[model samples]
Target chain A: MHNKTVAELSKGLAAGSFSSVELTQHFLTRIAQQDPALNSFITVCNDEALADAKAADAKIASGSASPWTGIPFAHKDIFCTQGVKTSCGSKMLDNFIPPYDSTVTRNFKQQGAVCLGKTNMDEFAMGSSNESSYYGRVVNPWGENLVPGGSSGGSAAAVAARLTPAATATDTGGSIRQPAALCGVTGLKPTYGRVSRYGMIAFASSLDQGGPIARTAEDAAMMLNVMASYDDKDSTCIERDVPDYTSTLNNSIEGLNIGLPKEFFSDHLNANMQQQVENAVKELEKLGANIKEITLPHTELSVPAYYVIAPAECSANLSRFDGVRYGHRCADPKDLEDLYCRSRTEGFGDEVKRRIMVGAYALSAGYYDAYYRKAQQVRRLIKNDFTAAFNDVDLIVGPTSPTPAFGFNSKGDDPVKMYLEDIFTISTNLAGLPGMSIPGGMIDNLPVGLQLIGNYFDEARLLNVSHQFQQATDWHTKTPKGFE
Target chain B: MSIKREDAENIARLAKLQISDEQLEKITGDLSNILSLVDQLKAANTQDIEPMAHPMDAVQRLRPDHITETDNREAFQKIAPATEEGLYLVPKVIE
Candidate 1:
């Protein structure tokens, strides 16, 4: 169960190799025994998962099963799951049970997929490393002393450890791709609004998008099929057609034009990372891709622009978490102001509060033009660079993150250094293009990820290209020593 | 663009989040680090460029205000720390 892909598991279930109940039970026992050390799961949905697994078994028995009918997966704790604890790694929402389910989770449930549990994340999806989570940091399964890239660290770690076949993840400024890069798993951030963000807790509205984390490109593609849909409930969801992602897994990439952004290979990138990404590019070239050099002139401005836009939006979206409505409230406050203050002071962590302050200042009356508005304008130019580049090329390639997984306390007490980790990934989010991270060769035994960015709604091509690369390399299949 | 303790407190007050002096000191340091990056964006040239709010041109599609959901309020509130008279209990206001 641990090493099998979603396609293999689904085939086994349909062919009477084993029932969904057995698979679910196997994963549950493994999670119960192993998750304590990794701290990957914040809440395990045992009862709900078992019930769904039994239903999936019935579907297989009746010859009416979906492709992923019995496969078990987990979600980042940020998604609102009905009757399940959906704490977004916050002390405030520690006991908050949402009345409704997030569109992503609901879609999974509708597919008869078994739920494993809720994985941990940085508090309110705020940090680059997972340390800001109130539930505690998620350690890398490969090396417990190293950090699992976050705020989607738990999802990445869970998939890397083979605790689940795949996990649902959200990326705002590299949350999904960065962690997957560090963990050596395949993760994708579909075009913004490709997957509805209806009941998913807001981080930064414009930048927040959901996608998948799995062991291989094929598994990610299958999960993408289940997750991609237009939900009227999500006001921002695009009303467009979703392609059959799995069908394109074997699509030929004979003439695919792959662009290498020259700015990404500069001296600032670590020597080891440059080597790994360059080697991965060579492999793609061997697969018959038409490789060429391209320049994104606005690459250097992404970090600064993102800090302004994301925090400003975060400041606004997070305002709803006042003590009055839902989540945490302080005890015995004298007035409204006191209640709001005490609740927030108690609720948010160090990283969340830092963003709120920065966001509030940027969105404030006097500073709005200098910070927020200017960032938005530059953001447009950044997107334009990609738009123009795509007209000349089919896809772009870069290092997913600047470096591999660093030590647990590597960037200690320095927020700016941590922010630089997403430099390659933030621009894709800014441009609203589909992006994926395929496992490149390791750097000093730590996994590195090669990033692929495609034209808008071209997730099928991105998956096809990644699938071809995975077929040629064993990096995606190489699991950590102890976990296997 | 460096944030000070007073600046953090003022922003906290504006955002309606309460904070203590000790918390303000640490938040000031962290915000200063973040804002230094924001300061770079503020320096960029955007004299006549229009700000892009969203990447898509699709208008917001709202679900009908009708209840397409279950009446799970009772089940939802079951986990709340305090409740009274079929509503969530919170710190009282208005003398």
Candidate 2:
């Protein structure tokens, strides 16, 4: 039961093969027993899960159950869960029990999905590795010593360990895809404005988009059916109709044009990892994809531009935590200024502070045009590159990260080194395009992700291609050693 | 493009974060490294490129000017660090 995908679990629930309570209990017990080492979950709601599962059982009995009715999954802590602690992996939010549910959480609840718990993440979704989480680093299920690429590391790791059949995750410059790649799961970041961001704690507003992480593309498609919606609450959420993402999963990809950017295949990618991505492409080719070499000339500038734009946006978004509100507040403040400074200082972790400081500096009066504005212009160039490439190809394919997951603290000392970890994944965010990471192959016992970048709001096509690829390959089915 | 100690201090102050003397040097170094990395943007010919604020160039949506939310002040203030009689308590801002 624990090893089953969400699709399989849903079928079992509908067939009455097992009760939602039994299935939910199985996952809750697995999390209790297995999560200590992986540290993937911040809060496991055993009681709440059982209650939700019981309700789902009733719904199933009534013959009014949706496909996700009894499905058990985890939500990344960044999404606000009413009455439950939604920490966003920060001590600042450690005590925050949202009085209301985020849009994403509400959608899941509406579907009658049993949420197992909230998974851990980088503080405010800032870091590339999960080490920045105040709850402590999440270990990769693939190898305990290797870092699960983050800030959605916990979500990816949870799905990889089969602690949950699926998990909700957000990506702002590779948070979802990188971790999914590292953990050997399928993760998708829908086009900007496709998924509502109303209750998602903002990292970089323009770049952040929520999606699903699951064992397979088919499972991810099921989760996205519930996640993608038009919400008036989130103004940025476009009014476009949400398609049934699973409908196109079996669509043939014959004559599909896939672009492989020359820049992505250069020295930035590890030779062996490149080979893995190429192998995945070859599989897609056999499925009738037409491969073509393309160029996104501004690829080298993406990381630099992202470093500026994301930090700048984050600095402003994070200012809401001023010690007077619901989050952590410092003691013994002599005045308002001290209260503000001390609370924020005590609340945020190092990476969070570094980004805030960088953002503040970039957006500062004298430097605004030089850094912030310059980065925005560079962002347009990056977007334009994608616009031009999409004209020639149906999708762009590459390695999700330059390399697979590294050991904890391997690049921690140097901020620039860590920034480069998302070199392959950031441009999609900059361009507001949909992108996904599917397990391509294993390198040195760790997983590498094959990235797919689609034209804006072309998620159905991305899911279709990814599902077709998974049907031909077994990479997404391979589980980590001890976990299996 | 290197961020000096004074720049780091000023940035922290603006961001309302307190960095102690012990942490300032390393913070400055890290900021400097980051600044230099972002300096790569200067090479791009962005002179004619329009700056993009949102990915889809989405304009903020406007709704009817009417109250949609039920008052939940009591529920909200329950989590505030300092609150009294439905008001958020804060350190003195004026004499």
Candidate 3:
């Protein structure tokens, strides 16, 4: 039951093979026994999950159950869950419980999905590895020593471990895809504004977008149907019609032109990872997709531009968390300035503070033209590069990260090396295009992701392409040794 | 432009974060490294292009200015670190 994909679970629920409460309990018990070792979850809502499951059972009995009714899923701690702690993997919000539900959680609740718990993440979605989580790092289920790439590491690990069929995750830069790649799961980041960001904590407002992480593209599509919706509450939410994402999963890709970025295949990529991606492309070719060599000239510019833009946006967004209104406050304050500084410094983790300080510096008066403004201009060229490539190809394909998951502390000393982990995944965010990471193949016993980048608002095509690849390959179906 | 130690301190103060002396040294180095990486952007020429704020060049959508929400201050304030009768408590800005 735990190993079933979301599609399989939907069929079982509709057939009355198991009650929602029973299914929910199966996952809850697995979490209790397994999560102590993984540390994938921040807070498990035991009583709430059971109650929701029971209600779902009643709803099923009444014959009003949706496909997602009673499906057990995890939410990344980035989303606000009413009455439950939405920590954003930060001590700042360690004890902060939202009085209201985030739009994403509300959408899930409306579908009657059972909430297993909130999964861990890098604090405020800042880091490439989950080590920055105040709750401690999440171990990759594949190998305990290796990291579950982050800041959506917990969601990817939870789905890979089959603790939950699928989980909601966000990508600010590579948060969702990089982790999904390392954990051997399927994750998607819809075009910016494709999903409402009303209650999802902001990292870089321009780059942050929420999507789903699941065992299969089919499962991800099912979850996306619920997660993507326009909310008037989120001013940036695109006022576009939400299609049935699962409806397009079986679409034919024959004669589809796929672009392979030349820069992504340079000497920078690991040899094993390059071979795995090459084989993945060969699989796509066998599936009747045409591969074209393309160029995103500004590819190398992404890392630097992202560092400036993301931090600049973060410094502004995080200013709302002053010691006064909500979140952690100082023990005592001699003055307002003391209150503000102490609370923030004590509340936030190192990675979060480092980003804030860098952001502040970038946006500072004298540095604005050189740093913030210059990065934005380069950001335009990056977007233009994508715009040109898409004219010749239906979609772009590349390795999600240069390599598979590394040891927990491999790049601990250097911040630049850590930032480069998202090198292959960041440009999609810069261009506000829809992108996805599907389990491509294994390298050194760890999974490498084949990233699919589609033109703006082309998620249907991306899901269709991913689903076709998944059908021809068993990469997405593989599970870690112990978890299996 | 590499960030100096004093630059990191000034940035921390502007960002409203208190950095201990030890954290200050480490942060300075990290920030400098990150900035050096970001300095790669200067290599790209952008003489005529406008700074792109969003990918889609989307203009902010306007809605009717009338009240679209009911008051939920009590529920919201319930989770505040310090609160008084229907208001958030903060260190006094004035004497």
Candidate 4:
């Protein structure tokens, strides 16, 4: 039961092989057994899950079931779940119980999908490694000592560990793709505004997009079918119609033009990691993709630009946690300033604070033009690079991270070294394009993710290509030894 | 691009985060390192390029001003630390 993908589980539920309550319990038991070691979940809603499962069971019996009915999944703590704690992996939100559901949560509830719990993440979706999580660092299920690449690390790790069939995750800057790569799973970051962001905690509004992390690309497509929707509540959510993502998963890739950015294969990427991505490309080529080397000249500038831009926006967005309305508040305060300062200082973790300070500095009086505006201009250059590349290619492919997951704390002290972990995937977010990371291969016993970047609103094609790649290879099917 | 301790302190203040003197030193160093990394953006020729504040070029969609929300003040304020008579309580701002 734990080994089945969401698609398989949905079929099993439709056939009544096992009741939704039984399926939900099976995953809850696995999480209870396995999550202690991985630290993947912050809140496991056993009671709520059982109740939802019972309701789903009735829906399935009545034959009024959507594909997601009776299926169990996890939500990254960033999404607000009514009456459940949506911590966002920070002390700031640890006490927050949203009065209403996020759009993503509401959609899943409407589909009657049973949610197991909220997965851990880097505090406020701010770090590359899950270590920044106030709950605790989530261990990569692949290896005990290796860090699970993050912000969405717990979601990726949980899916890798089979605690849930699929989990909802968001990517600000490689949060979904990098962690999915490290944990040896499939994850997607949809085009900006492709999914509604209302009630999904804000990090970097421009770069943040919610998607799915799952064991297979087909499963990810199924999850996207439910996750992608337009809502007036989220002003940034595109008003365009969303296609059924799963409908295109089996589409042929014959004569598909795939671009490999020359800069992505440079010395910056590990040699062995490059080989794995090249192998995935070869497999794609066998599936009828025509591989060509293209240039995204501004690739190297993405990380620098992202640092300035993300923190700048975050400083403004995070200002809402001032202790006056909600979230962590100090015991006593002398004045309004004291309440604001102490509450925020205590609520946020070091990485969160560091970003806030950097953001404040970038948007400061004299530095605004030099830092904030300059980074935005560079962002345009980065987006233009993708626009030009798409003229000759159907999609771009590259290694998701420079390397596989590194040892815990390896790059912790050096912020820049940590930032570069997202070097390859950050540009996609900058361009507001859809990107998917599928298990490419293993390097040094850890998984390597091959990233697929689609042109704006081309998630259907990306899902199709990823599904075809999975069919040609067993990389996506391999599970960690202990979990299996 | 290096950040001074005073600058870091000032930034923390502006951000409304109280940083102790001990953490300030380390934070200042980290900020300097991050700044140096972003400083590379200076080399890029972005002349005449408009800053992209949002990914999409869409303008803000304005709707007719009308009440769309139900009263949920009690439910929302339930999570607040201190509330009295439907008003959020905070530190004294006026004498």
Q: Give the local distance difference test score of model 4.
A: 0.93
Provide TM-scores for the models.
0.97, 0.99, 0.99, 0.99
Chain B of candidate 3 vs. true chain B, TM: 0.91
**Which prediction has the highest lDDT against the true structure?**
2
lDDT of 1 by residue, A322-392 (tens): 77657888888877778878888898887787788788999998888888888989999899899889988
Candidate 4 local Cα displacement, residue A355, angstroms: 0.5
lDDT of 2 at A101: 92
- Enumerate residue pairs that collide in model 3: none
Chain A TM-score of each candidate structure, as shown = 0.99, 0.99, 0.99, 0.99
- List, in the given order, the native-contact fraction of each candidate: 0.69, 0.95, 0.94, 0.89
In the range A367-402, model 4's lDDT, one tens digit per residue, is: 899999999999999999998999999999999999
**A326-408 per-residue lDDT for model 3 (tens digits):** 89888989888999889998999888898888899988988899999999999999999999998899999999998899998
Residue pairs with backbone overlap in model 1: A341-B18
Mark the 10 consecutive residues where model 1 chain A has the least summed lDDT.
A320-329
Report the Cα lDDT for residue B45, model 2. Answer: 93
Query: Model 2 residue A342 lDDT?
Result: 93
Kindly list the interface RMSD, in angstroms, of each predicted candidate in the order they appear: 2.0, 0.9, 1.0, 0.9
Residue-by-residue lDDT tens digits, candidate 2, A1-484: 9888888899999999999999999999999999999999999999999999999999999999999998899999999999999999999998999999989999999999999999999999998899999999999998889999999999999999989999999999999999999999999999999999999999999899999999999999999999999999998999999999999999999999999999999998878998999999999999999999999999999999999999999999999999897999999899998999999999999999999999999998988999999999999999999999989999999999988889987885888998999999999999999999999999987888999999999999999999999999999999898787
Q: RMSD in angstroms, all models?
A: 1.6, 0.8, 0.9, 0.8
Best by DockQ: 2
